[model samples]
Target: PSNNETEQHSSQVDQIEEEPVRYELPLRTNRDVPPKRYTPEKEARRSRYPMANIAKGNLSPEAQIFTTSLYFEEISTSVEQALESKV
Candidate 1:
């Protein structure tokens, strides 16, 4: 090889020696554990009073009218739509 080629190769090797070496990160191994099962009585309480389930013994007549009106409006709207499509 020529003297210029040897000098250029030595210059590249000197630049590489001056630069810091790269490193890889270590792998993580930590994980979380889940909670255990729920009891039967706890399940019953959540089921019985699910936000919309009004107590028959506690609701007044006026409140009942409001609830029934909502149901009737929904039923009437569905029925009207069904009838209109038949033609």
Candidate 2:
């Protein structure tokens, strides 16, 4: 009898309700954060990887053309500049 009363009370206590969730939009704090600008020198290095890979075997007819482009020249120039600046 005591066990049944305890179980009934426990079940009633567990039936308490919960509040629904409310959604809010995010507030931006840094409105003045400037957008990124791309330069030709920066873009040259970015284009080197694919060209380098394609020129790996030196098999493609365009491989020579690809490696000899102005893009690779910029990459080489940047690397040399970096090394020179260190000394």
Candidate 3:
């Protein structure tokens, strides 16, 4: 390349380098806590699992009955075995 063209290219590069680099602040939320929005997608995903409902204390009557019946059955069985062994 010619001297004049080389000088022009160097000057152009120098001008670019001399220009102040602009740094933008990262996008941030002003609130310390995130806003709670009701998302139908999340609701639908949670509703897809039966255990999630139980976890949230939304037990059906039948489930409550079954759980209590099983608990009582275990207690009754243990008591019966204890009585039989004593006899």
Backbone clashes, each candidate: 0, 0, 0
On a 0 to 1 TM-score scale, where does candidate 1 land against the true structure? 0.27
lDDT of each: 0.71, 0.64, 0.69
* Cα misplacement distance, residue 76 of candidate 3 (Å): 18
| lDDT score, candidate 2, position 30 | 69
lDDT, candidate 2, 1-87, per-residue tens: 699999998887776553456788687776787766755565444564564465456457576666667465533358778787677
* Candidate 2: segments with Cα more than 4 A from true spot: 1-22, 38-49, 55-87
Per-residue lDDT of model 3, residues 8-81, tens digit only: 99999999889698899987776587667765565544455553345424668887787657656533358778
Better of 1 and 3 by TM-score: 1
Any runs in candidate 1 off by more than 4 Å, and if so which?
1-52, 75-87
Worst 10 residues of 3 by lDDT: 48-57
Better of 1 and 2 by lDDT: 1
Give stretches of model 3 more than 4 Å off.
1-3, 19-23, 30-52, 55-65, 70-87
lDDT of 1 by residue, 1-87 (tens): 999999999999999889687687776444354445654556433565464776756779998778778766533358778797677
Could you tell me the lDDT of residue 25 within candidate 2? 68
